[model samples]
Target: MKKVKPKDIKGHIEYLADDRLLGRMPGTEGYKMAADYVIDKFKSMGIEPAGENGSYLQDVTIRKAVTGNDATFISRDSLGNKSELIHGKDFVIFPNAVEKQTTLEAPLVFAGFGISAPEIGYDDYAGIDATGKVVVVMRGAPDSFTSTVAASSMDIGNILQTAANHGAVGVVMAFTNPTAGVPNISRGVNSVLGPDGGIAVSRYYVSDDVKLFSFISGETLTNFLAKAGLDFNTSLTSLKNATPVSAPLNTTIRASYSSSHEDINSYNVIGKITGSDPLLKNEFVIHSAHLDHVGIGAPVNGDSIYNGAHDNASGVASLLEIARIYSRIDAKPKRTVLIAMVTGEEMGLLGSSYFAKYPTVPKQNIVANINTDMPTIIAPLLSVVALGAEHSTLDKPVANAASYLGLDVEEDPEPEQNRFVRSDQYSFVSQGIPALHIKYGNKTPDGKNNLNEQVQVWREKYYHKPQDSIDGTFDFDAGKTYVQLNFLIGYQVAQNPERPSWNPGDFFETAR
Candidate 1:
């Protein structure tokens, strides 16, 4: 088989990342154009379509819901006093936590960091009857978890979910960072349908005026408990001892106004090159990259189009290049090689989630998924930060492939960043499929300082903002080597001897 050429890969990337694509946001005309280009690339490259039957498009079902004016929110206190909280004025609210506009009049308990970690033998909601009342927890993790992070070992998000699971009617979490602020709520796209309609993600906040009650911070709640002379560690106990000092805690808030989401049709672009052996053909090697970006935003430097040239335009380029290489290889995989350019990734892995719900191929046969989202900008590639690196028996296959490219396979530098749980790969991982994700190290090309400083500079100034446009100074040279590493992964998985698996003691492994 001939080696993939860097020149050919760049040609496809140049066209896809061109200003014409308009950032390739899903459900938009520009997204349609990008989708069409992807299918066309497959046709031109002579890659066999492996979507459905013989089609190139694996159509995914999606439901969009916009908060209608009919959806109203209000609150009443113990004195039977009530106030109408205006919508979209005070803060943003999501119907996500619970279906109906939850009305909580029972005692409001301030639960300290509402975290529960069985592994650590701790439960924040322990011995608390918080069924109908709202528990005000603090933003971020508890002290125990923060200490673990400083020692390079921390995973508290899972513990945070305990509040919802433990029957807390509603949760009000406050921020501790006075300098930095919490992320504003963003609009959600419902990919999975529910008994009511669809399960929508959280909502973007509106300004003050719509809130049913006052919002309290963790610091303030903690202070209130401390002033009451109760043990702070015993959160519920403290709340129980401290008698109510106020008649009603009411705060006004509002939710952002957007068109109620309508069902938007979309598809996952898939192409495949089948293997030779019959038994091996049943197996698969999956290569994926998301094709969605933040659509239109307010405006940046007079340009509203966020031509996400670097965000994932770089990723799609890598995907297409791999497809072209696999298509032209003299010898194909022992199993099938799947090249997928998934959609709705910006919308909570919606496309991949939909694919999991309706797979074109058997989910059991998929060996592993390699999803590339953010690429290594001009920075050097030192190691492969495989997100679920420890879960699978496929680590050797990755190392074998990496060795072929003279690259090292390493665990993610920022697992705390939760890249494993952040991208399209998580959609498949949730279903027990082993996944590998590679990204760049946090260092500048010139090695002047850690890339985190610059990234912080960019995130504050550009991240997800209209300012995230590509500039001349960005280092893109890493793309070539990055693709080299991926090409090896694509080939090796296609020809690997054993299937990847979730390692022993992995939570997802037991789920499967």
Candidate 2:
């Protein structure tokens, strides 16, 4: 396949991430506009509308809810003294309390991390039953600075699900390090127009005075513990004990939060290039990317667009380029190629989750999913970082494509980041589909363990900030490599007789 100028993609990313678009926050006009733009492009490409209703639009049913003005968690001491905390201002909380009222006078159990991993021989819930009580768990991982989870690799989200599964009535997180918790996409205290430069919305529902749980900052909790004359480490350890005395302290939580916005329906743009063989037409090679970004928000450094350039504009751009290449190819593939740009990815991967739950096509026939996200801002195309590379038939194919491009391919620099669960691919993974998420550019040529230069730069800047905009000249050649490689992977998978599956002992292997 011949490579064309990546102008269309470059132009698309710039337009979508533009400040005037107001940070493509889903359920906003700008977000709808972004989706419309993708639909229009799909139509212009002469690709068939592969979404529902014979169109490129797949309704994501985006929604937003503003919680009540104030939330107070009041607790009474045995002496009849009482205190209260405000909502948003004091702390932000998510509630599963579907009803109007919830009362908890039960004992509060301190569960260590609320994690249970037999493979690692650690069980936070071992010998403990938190059934009717509020469970106090530490936020982030137990090994805050050391490891995200086990001596292996895991992140907060992975540990969170485990916590949620343990029937912990309410979770009170003891924040050890605020800085450590900042990387948590769900835990940010202040969010403006995300780096996507669009207004962004919170994933958890909000309601005034609703108290499913309340947060205590690490500093505050630590200070208060010191003031109360409790040995912090001892208390921390005691909380994790299976059997412990309940210390009911007079407590109160208060918070105040507000947002202003217009609501609009969002869409997932879908396009398809049909295959040559009639019998294999139903088969598909899917390329996915999220098109939505955090809409406009509070100013940061006098710039608020948060253009989400690398966060995803880069991804959507790559999707378009791949679509263009496949569409222009003279030799057709045996299976169809589906280009799906999802919305509400920043909102807990909602769009992709909906698609996975209710696919327009047969899920089993999907040969593979190539997720393009945050392609590159670094110049000089070096190598491809294959995340979730451990379990897949796509690995060798990726290697083959890399060889074809004269580029080296290696494992992700930080495999423990759980990049697998960080994007839309996880939705498919949950459905048992084999997927690959590749990050192009800033690759290590020698394949040594040294960090990619761009990665180091990204840690300091351009990561989920308004600075992600594409202003100065950026070499997009690496993006082309990503598209080409994925195109080949898809093309190869289309012709292969065997279906892709997970390797032995991989968590999602049973998803097959």
TM-scores of the candidates are 0.76, 0.77
Name the TM-score of candidate 1: 0.76
What is the C-alpha local distance difference test score of candidate 2? Answer: 0.62
Q: 395-424 in candidate 2: lDDT tens per residue?
A: 877888889888778656664555667788
Predicted model with the maximum TM-score: 2
The alpha-carbon RMSD values of the candidates against the true structure, listed in the order shown, are 6.4, 6.2
What candidate 2 gets wrong by more than 4 Å, as runs, is 66-69, 75-91, 95-105, 119-122, 142-164, 178-213, 219-264, 276-280, 300-302, 414-418, 441-451, 458-461, 510-512
The count of backbone overlaps in candidate 2 is 38
